[model samples]
Target: MLTQTRNVEEKLYFNRFVVDAGRPHITVRPHERPSAELRSLTHMCPAGCYSQNEAGQVEIATDGCLECGTCRIVTARTGEVEWNYPRGGFGILYKFG
Candidate 1:
């Protein structure tokens, strides 16, 4: 049997995201800006949904989120993030295993 191999980006292309406008499932607390946990999210998130703003504050855009819960785990004890599942039918849809 011939198997196909795909890179991370390529595999990710098979996934689809349904964004919930005006109702982001994940948000960075403004009061928690510039924290070590938030900073770590910038690089730790597999979907790259977290980033550092010009003012050195962490920000989140939930559109392309893989919903892997990395952010939640990283900031769970810090109270620096708000994490939840998107509304039903709005979130990542994995096309392949």
Candidate 2:
């Protein structure tokens, strides 16, 4: 049987992006407590940028974000994330057609 074997991370790596290192377009609520859904971001993010720190708080690294909006939707229940599109020339840039 023939089948394709490309993962989300692999595809993200191929795509180009201009990350605003100085400014993250997304941020998890530092004041609010973490919920299951928020914690899920660690695995849900295609870029694998969201993760738990030593303190067990959800931390997001927006650099590798695919701009897929998954985090915003997943964490909608708590509204613990502040998400916004990167500047006009920033963020993910899909090169493959």
Candidate 3:
């Protein structure tokens, strides 16, 4: 048996993302401004989709989202995030088992 290890970035390269134009499955609610909960997403999102702007505001770009549900899980009770699964055939397609 042979064993191989790859870092997250390297492993991600084998996956494909089918993004739905003008339709994002995850978004930061408009009324939810920057806060501890929002800021926490910047560190918690494994895909690095959340970031802090110069004005100390949290923003999200769903282009490379892994669709892992981390954001939803973290803010499930806050209503700060609106999350749904992308339309059929428009999301992550894992190439590796």
Backbone collisions counted per model: 0, 0, 0
Tens digits of per-residue lDDT, candidate 2, 1-89, equal 99767776666568887988788899888854699999998998878889898888889888767889999999898898999999889
Clashing pairs in 1: none
Name the regions of candidate 3 deviating beyond 4 angstroms: 1-3
Q: What is the C-alpha lDDT of each candidate?
A: 0.88, 0.85, 0.84
Q: Rank the candidates by TM-score, best first.
A: 1, 3, 2
Evaluated at residue 69, the lDDT of candidate 3 is 89
What's model 1's TM-score? Answer: 0.91
lDDT of 3 by residue, 9-91 (tens): 88999988888999988888764366677789999998889998887767788987888888888887777888998899998
lDDT of 1 by residue, 1-97 (tens): 9999999889999999998899999998886356788799989998888888788888899989998888999898887999999999999999876
* Clashes in predicted model 2: 0
Between candidates 1 and 2, the one scoring higher on TM-score is: 1
Off by over 4 Å in 1: none
Model 1: residue 25 alpha-carbon error in angstroms: 0.4
